[model samples]
Target: MTDTALVVGGTRFIGRHTVSDLLANGYDVGMLNRGNHENPFADDGRVTHIEGDRTDERDLRAAKLSTEPDVVIDCVAYHPRDVETAVDVFGDVDGYVYVSSGSSYAEEAIPKREGETPLRPCTPEQATDESGETYGNRKAEGDRVAFAAAEAGVNAMAVRPCVVYGPHDYTERLDYWIDRVLTHDRVVVPGDGQNLWHRAYVEDVASALRTVAERGEPGAAYNVGDRRALTLAETVETVAEAAGTECEAVPASADALAAGGLDPDDFPLYREYPHLLDTCALAALGWESTPVDEAMARTVADHRESDRDGNEWDPGRDAEERVLGVKETL
Candidate 1:
């Protein structure tokens, strides 16, 4: 059981949390990445960090030989070219937990229920060579290649989280709205305030990834999202309440937000999907969501406490004090 768990691109927001969870849960963790950001586990000597590029074949091959992990939890993979690189490097590994996305679901055309349809089924070389337009498409294509390789040989499982939010999130997606509602008392939305959004805490997502690495059945796909699908307005209100303050949240037009450089990136808040996810399957595996109210409060607290010298989130500065992205002003 001490065999190492290789985390590819494990320096990102979700990757950090998952690495922590893996370490805490008794796995010998090893991170493989380009050494871009500050090392999240700088203090911990229990795990090894292999600085390399997953997209690069030589780098990945060297990492595979060095770590020789039992499980490979991919945290960054976009193109099939990346998948090709990974499989070429690690010909045989225990479990391959691909960090795929729930966006693989074709929610625009069909309501995505678990097993409702095979997720991003294998496509021909010409047909699947390109992707990554939307969150769903990129994730779907990535998952397609990963699952196909797993089918060939390798214990592979995928988890599609609705919207992952926690400390140090890349893209600063959730913090934007949460900070706006809690601090600025202004919530922006497009078209209708009623358009819904779904989100999951980073810790919960991390734990789910760990669980899959530990006990996930091979080639299985699990949706790790909360059932609490709240509309944008309601989510704002809930965030405000969790912030322990009564504030005004004025919904600005989409044009205003876009002009203000508030264009939604990773988690588009105003996307219209009645049901973002049915995460019952993840829960069935004994993976639970940190309560809505609790997670919300923690997010708010972390945001507030993250204020360092009143300049909490300037990317130009170098510091591990905020080893994550902060879009406090939204």
Candidate 2:
């Protein structure tokens, strides 16, 4: 009587964690992907690998026939057409969850809610464009596609996550901060150190996907994040605490950052405006997020075990040091 689940992109980041969560919850899992990345669950008896390209409809159809999944978690649909194709292919599944983003919200609200917030409108050009500039538009359109599919009797849902971070996070966004806390005694923080950016732990997002698939209302979108959104300063402190270290968070103003020949955006996880999401809807599905402290601890442990210094995200210590010196004189 075990439920069968198929993850479209199961070898990386959020998709990777989703596969693990489903398996732990007594579901037989199958992964359909291009097999470009190494499969962590390759040898596991409970997991199956269905090699295919998600962008190819023939491949998706083949995977559906091979797995006969009760639920489908799509992690790689980037365009509206992708969702349209998926809905056509897996419309018969018990639940079809599309991975959406908080960026899909059109307006700047304190806390973006699922139904109340306005979703960005996607133009025909944006729908087909593969650039990051049109990502929000594309995601919003994908959500609309899912809703339309649900209206047609497909159990399609969407889960929007802002800034997801944890083990195997290829984005390396949070890894930059973890690297700073581990290597530097003084970490340069933007503005008042209270810049808030809601982030979801990878495991929490994974669980949210499953929960939404199981108990979520058809055509509804759910936001996922830690119940307690941490400020930039608090996040640094948490990372330091989790790493068992003492590091000072040095606050830098816009002028100070410019003096150092850098901008606020140069710092990873720093946002000019607060970007928050209301996860109460997801929580109502009997899902809970991991405590920030516990999440940071696991992230730090994974960072310590890897070689990701997040240098791509770092503007350079010399520049940050100049900013610190400017702050000291101020």
Candidate 3:
């Protein structure tokens, strides 16, 4: 029997890659989304695009998405309500894989291990806030809800991935550095650029999701990311090398960047503390991730090929350049 999988938000980024992996693995795939984005898999006959709002129970029922799928890969279930609606609608499936964020973990020791620290759960009000200050907590609540559904007979697991980069990255987090390195002689490094960062390749994340769908334990959460962590300076160097460009790293204080109108939140890797995640559980599942250098190369190449329209630069680049210029003056 051919396994059938339903991918929520399947037209972009990790979700897009996951759908491609499912199709390549011989799984008959169905995608649920609002149909506003361009469909990359429109020509693939094996994929059935189910246009519906994931939040609306009526849309889900109308699309018949709840009926007996072998697996459900939810890439956008960020809130507790999203998880609850999925469990309430999809009742039972052989496997349910939730694409969660590593941010769901409360601040813990470096190289944070799964199950070592309690997750921070957000209140309903906090989850609905638009400022995104409670994003991690809200995702934690979603994970909790998924686990609760597992207790109610839904076989579900959550995969927490650190910063995901590579092809089809709409956020342009990695691309920000790539563009700057390619276009500028000097790039600003926030906070000494020594904070260790961990990220996962989008393809690796997709593979991890497929692995969880196939063999993951119910109610389990796995942290999936690169085996090694790189500092922000090292990351910029990697991108520069990949792009075959030479650029100097100019150290800038976070306060200085903020003074120049660059939000600290905008630069995720430039943090005061290291954001490392231990992926031993994922490795123990017999999965290996792409090396950071190789993934960076592929990401830079892809960005150059597909995103060369020159609009991917950060909107605050002028402010950042002004800050760097002032530091040069000093």
Candidate with the greatest TM-score versus the true structure: 2
Candidate number with greatest lDDT: 2
In candidate 2, what are the lDDT values of residues 199-289, reduced to their tens digit?
A: 9999999999999999999899999999999999999999999999999999888888998899999988889899999999999899999
Residue-by-residue lDDT tens digits, candidate 3, 1-330: 898989988998999999999988999888889999999999988888888998887876655544346888999887778888887777677888888899998876688887786788687797776567888988888888888988888898899999998998887777778888888879888877786768889999999999988988888899988887778888888888988889887778767776688755566455677778888888888889988889989989898888543354454678878778778777
Query: Could you tell which candidate, 2 or 3, scores higher by TM-score?
Result: 2
Ranking by TM-score: 2, 3, 1
Report per-prediction Cα RMSD to one decimal: 7.3, 0.7, 2.6
Clashing pairs in 2: none
TM-score of 3: 0.90
State candidate 2's TM-score.
Answer: 0.99
Question: TM-scores of all models?
Answer: 0.80, 0.99, 0.90
Sorted by lDDT (best first), the order is: 2, 3, 1
- Candidate 2: count the clashes: 0
Candidate 1 RMSD to the real structure: 7.3
Q: After superposition, which runs of candidate 3 have C-alpha atoms over 4 Å from their true positions?
A: 62-67, 254-268, 308-330
Task: Indicate whether candidate 1 or candidate 3 has the larger lDDT.
Answer: 3
